[model samples]
Target: MEEWTIEINRSATKKEKPNTDQLEFGRVFTDHMFIMDYSVPLGWHDARIIPYQPFSIDPSAMTFHYGQSVFEGLKAYYTPEGNIQLFRPEKNMQRLNRSNDRLCIPPIDEAFVLQAIKQLVYLDKDWIPTAEGTSLYIRPFIISTEPFIGVAPSHQYRLIVILSPVGAYYKEGINPVKIAVENQYVRTVKGGTGEAKTGGNYAASLKAQELCSQKGFTQVLWLDGVEKKYIEEVGSMNVFFKINGKVYTPALNGSILEGVTRNSVIQLLQHWNVPVIEERISMEVLYQAYLDGSLEEAFGTGTAAVISPIGQLSWEDKDLYINDGKTGKISRDLYNTLTRIQYGKEKDPFGWIDIVNEANAVKQ
Candidate 1:
């Protein structure tokens, strides 16, 4: 195994940290960031921590035209005991490599990069918010930096990690939200890049999202591209529906992004002896269930909101109000349990918490 060492470069002038209570999602960033470079023969090299300032990339960079990139989102929480910890960060690292495979980017050393993330978070520990529903959002992304216009994959890449103190992902917090079902625009197909956590997948969603947002919807509920019948995703999160007494979410169908929070919610449901199923769930079936009063609740799960209750889902001028347009029991419970575990208020039986040792902080 090759030894990977990250060189440290502290920022001379630190930026003002935002007020925790007034924090919004991804608006305010911390002082330092982690970066690494990769090329054909060198693999990944020049790992370092430096000031959070933008560096110039060539105007004709491949990433600008070819859109070859991948990214991951996770967070660090401030425990009541004055310690900082991450919630299942290894899963994010593994997912990043999976995205890399889809994008034809070089694989990164997951363990080493995870260490660098912890060190970077710990180095800026003061930026970790203590307010409820607040956390230090961590973003790890890779961009094709080779300044070439050809269609082939780039020979060079840059991986960078930046931190932001964020509040609730949705303005509603843990409350239920209204979503618009999209039938015209497709997110991705089974054999396409939908499963990859790349910028193109999100870029594909912007049009529908914008249209839905104009109609007073919080997010857009996407249907599968091939048929436009089965449920795929809800904006950026994986969706679930509770009918009768069992919970069902769309299975990993290669076109749907596998979400870390979605997996955790499934595990938690299983742990609680709740029946949760992963299968093809169609909007017609869901609407019929709602008509028969069997569709009890609906929610979307992701690292951002953890769990966003679906108050109402509108499709073809019909509004399916879930749980009377209020937060459902299951949704509230999952949010509370997951968040408690994240903030270190509840016992972590799943061994998901990774503690960041403050003692490892590099001196300025």
Candidate 2:
């Protein structure tokens, strides 16, 4: 692993830290950003931390014209001892590289990316809200910069990381969310970039998401492109089901995004002796489970909400109620456990939190 050299952007100063009380998710940003340029010949170089500002891309830039871009989302938390840490960031790095592979984007060393994020977080530590359920949302993205009209991978690329102070994902409350099962539009198909965290997948889901909001649903529960009967995942998170006291999630189909929160929740459930089953769960089976009183709970996992419990799922004509339209016992337990570990309120038995204080965790 190569060490990242810090280039402090002293040009910016701390502004009024947004009222930790009224923070919004991914709306307000911090002071500085970390960026690097990539070229086929030079690879990733010219890394620096600079003031947060807009960039001027060529009208013909590949990313602008052809949509050759990918991104990842993760968070930084402030521990009780005033220390900063990232939760399972290695998983996010690995997922970003996986998305890179599928998009023909160059692979990045996880060590390098991790170091960059750590440096950025330490520099912008004040942006991390101390309020419970608030975090410093980190967005790492790669964009093709080759100014060409041709349809192909850009020889030149740019990777940038930005920080945002985010409050609780559910502004109204943690009340369970309603979801609309999308049977008409498919999120991803076999051998497609559905598994990748590319911009196009998100762009494709905008219409569906709009439709969801219009229909009084929080998000769209995406299904497989071919069968449409098999549940894949939610819009931006992985879906989970609990039937007959056993937890079940859709197996990693080629069309689903493997979320870090999804992985962490599964590991935590296993540690707590909860029965977790990953298999190809069909919509019909889930409805049957609900009818038979075997379906106990359902939720979506992601960085934003950690775990968002689903109250009800409505397909075109049918509606399935989950656990009296409230947060289930297992869902509450997992959320509390994860948040406790994050805020340093609970001992980290899984070695998941990466403490970032060199003076404490390491000797300078």
Candidate with the greatest TM-score versus the true structure: 1
lDDT of 1 at 147: 86
Clash counts per candidate, in order, are: 0, 0
Candidate 2 achieves a global lDDT of 0.86
Give all TM-scores, in the order shown: 0.98, 0.96
Predicted structure 1: clash tally: 0
Q: Which regions in candidate 2 have their CA more than 4 angstroms from the true location?
A: 171-173, 358-364
In lDDT terms, how accurate is model 1?
Answer: 0.93
Candidate 1 residue lDDT tens string, 1-364: 3697789988899899887668988878899999999998988999999999989999989999999999999999998898788999999999999999999999999998999999999998889988777899999999999989999999999999999999755545668899999989999999999889999999999999999999999999999998899999999999999899999999999999999999999999999999999999999999999999999999999998899999999998899999999999999899999999999999999999999995567764
lDDT of each: 0.93, 0.86
Worst 10 residues of 1 by lDDT: 167-176
Per-residue alpha-carbon lDDT of candidate 2 for residues 1-364, written as tens digits (9 for 90 to 100): 7765546565345766789888977878888788998898888888888878798888888998888889999888998789898898898899899998888889887888888788777777878998877889999999999989899888999999999999877666567999999977777798899989999998989989998899899999998899899999887999999888889999887888888888888898899888999999999999999999999999999888888999999977999889989999988888888888887889999999997765321111
Best by lDDT: 1
Residue pairs whose backbone atoms clash in candidate 1: none
Q: What is the lDDT of residue 150 in candidate 1?
A: 97
